[model samples]
Target: MTPDSLSRRQLLTLTGSAAAAAALASLSLTGCSDRYKLRCQHQRTGEVYRELNIEIGSVITHSWIHSIELSRWTDIYRFDGETLMLTSTEFEAYGAGMPLDEGDVSVQDGQVVIENIDREFEAIRWIHSHRVDYRIGVDGDESLIDTDALPDLEPLELRPK
Candidate 1:
């Protein structure tokens, strides 16, 4: 092959290698968990939750609601899987501990049915102002919830540290 052709091939190979290395490095640093940026605001009090990364786990409420785990930079909370069924703004508001009435944030034919967005926005603001850290699992219990009590939500395959 000509020197020009060989040089071009080498450059292409080097570029490809660099890109692959960068991608791998980023993946290793970030991990496979789902990342979220949830902002909660309650009135003047507002908190921005950044870089929330959570692994797959079951979050069960009293009525067997399956909530997906969420995190702030420091604290963690869980939202019902149905919550994702809403819009991004709605999700953020809910993450902030705003009230979600059936008509405001529920799904109808797979679409977000939010009418009074202002109310939700206010609620989010209120939550952030309150300085409430989102929490996961049973109230006042660090132990894994009994599998029998939660027929829908399963126990953590791995024990909590």
Candidate 2:
């Protein structure tokens, strides 16, 4: 055909290149193409984990009834695709193993609320208890862990997936 007209192979290549460029532009505009899922797993074995959809500002909370205090304790985390930020915490009562030196403390619904902690952690680990309630929550949706069924004192963690 004419010198200005693209051959079949050249046309196909151009179409593929344009499609790839559009896909990349879409990802750049949406601004979270590399988002990670919040994952919970058995720490030692690196198994038996669950992954939950997480956005840049997604909130993850882990709460449990403290065995010694027999009261509720909750930790609030924010996921940023690469790390988890400990944003706040709530303790029902002061007792063993509780933070007493933290700043920005207040009382919300009778629980001691500590905000603006703003600490980053690669993974958060905890022990599974047979005698207390344990749960993992994301954006108000919660899943209760069968802590009693897990091996006594089995370790578990939440990290970027």
Candidate 3:
């Protein structure tokens, strides 16, 4: 073969090798190329849950309604490079003979905070009512919740199969 042809072949091989190496480097930086399956279940009712299959740098929201009470639950999460962080979650339930409940949970500084309110009838004639509120912070954050911005329960983690 001509020298020129030989030189061109060597250049092509080098270029292909460089491309493959770059791709492998990218895969290594991403840790795992496979998508992870994430799941979070209700704290009270184990039957209610949210599931997602996702990869790093992905955001997902899963919601479902209780089969019997028609209560709703929604969870939003974002997968950072290392962990899946909870952004927000909400649960609301209203039914006969049950207290009207609303709950919210949010993440702040790598910790989770929760606020909830329950309302129920105080008398048989429905002439009186009562409300109870709760605020909780998890993950070593002791800061009190802002009463005005009280928001909504389950924590979720993503795992590789």
Candidate 4:
């Protein structure tokens, strides 16, 4: 084949290779069980907290997590797996902010716990504070998920935050 013809064939092969690589990249992400979103509520106070969206690929399933946030209310001093993060604005108002004096956030036995409990300012703090963890899954059951679920979403009416 002529030089120009050879170059055209090489270009086509490279294009196909690139397309295959891209497809494989996306497929690998889908195959991994590490990424998903969760909706949870606090068993106590019947308060709700929606964690909007969380990409857990980088977060360990059962590990201590240190977070920094700016807020006047709902100072989330600590959290365990049991402690749920609000998924939306509505639920956030209901779940309430974690107490500040409680101490550092920590994960224990696959659960998250906040030390202090300042019921008096929870509500007000939730609205003002930028950090909070007090929502629970409606069924209180955890599910391995590939897609985000909104139990509080319309139609299903899973839970009223």
CA lDDT of each prediction against the hidden true structure: 0.30, 0.74, 0.39, 0.30
Q: Model 2, stretches more than 4 Å misplaced?
A: 1-34, 144-152
lDDT of 3 by residue, 15-44 (tens): 576764665566557654444543333233
Give the Å shift of residue 7 in candidate 4: 46
Q: What TM-score against the true fold does each predicted structure earn?
A: 0.22, 0.73, 0.29, 0.20
Which stretches of model 4 miss by more than 4 angstroms?
Answer: 1-28, 31-35, 40-53, 57-71, 77-101, 104-161
Q: How would you encode candidate 4's per-residue C-alpha lDDT over 33-77 as one tens digit per residue? A: 222333334333443445323332212121111233222122221
User: Given candidate 3, what's the lDDT at residue 143?
Assistant: 35
* 1-161: candidate 1 lDDT, tens digit per residue: 42222333464475586765665455557652243222221223222222133232422122122134332221122333212111222232234444455344565443333443321111111111112233223323333333233222121221111
How far residue 149's Cα lies from its native spot in candidate 3, in Å, is 38
Comparing candidate 3 with candidate 4, which one achieves the higher lDDT? 3
- Ten contiguous residues minimizing lDDT sum, candidate 1: 120-129
Question: For model 2, what is the error of residue 21's alpha carbon versus the real structure, in angstroms, after optimal superposition?
Answer: 12
Candidate 1 at 97: error in angstroms?
A: 21
lDDT value, candidate 2, whole model: 0.74
Per-residue lDDT tens digits of candidate 2, residues 45-123?
9876576667778788888887677788899998876789999999888766767776588888898999988889998
How many clashing pairs does model 3 include? Answer: 4
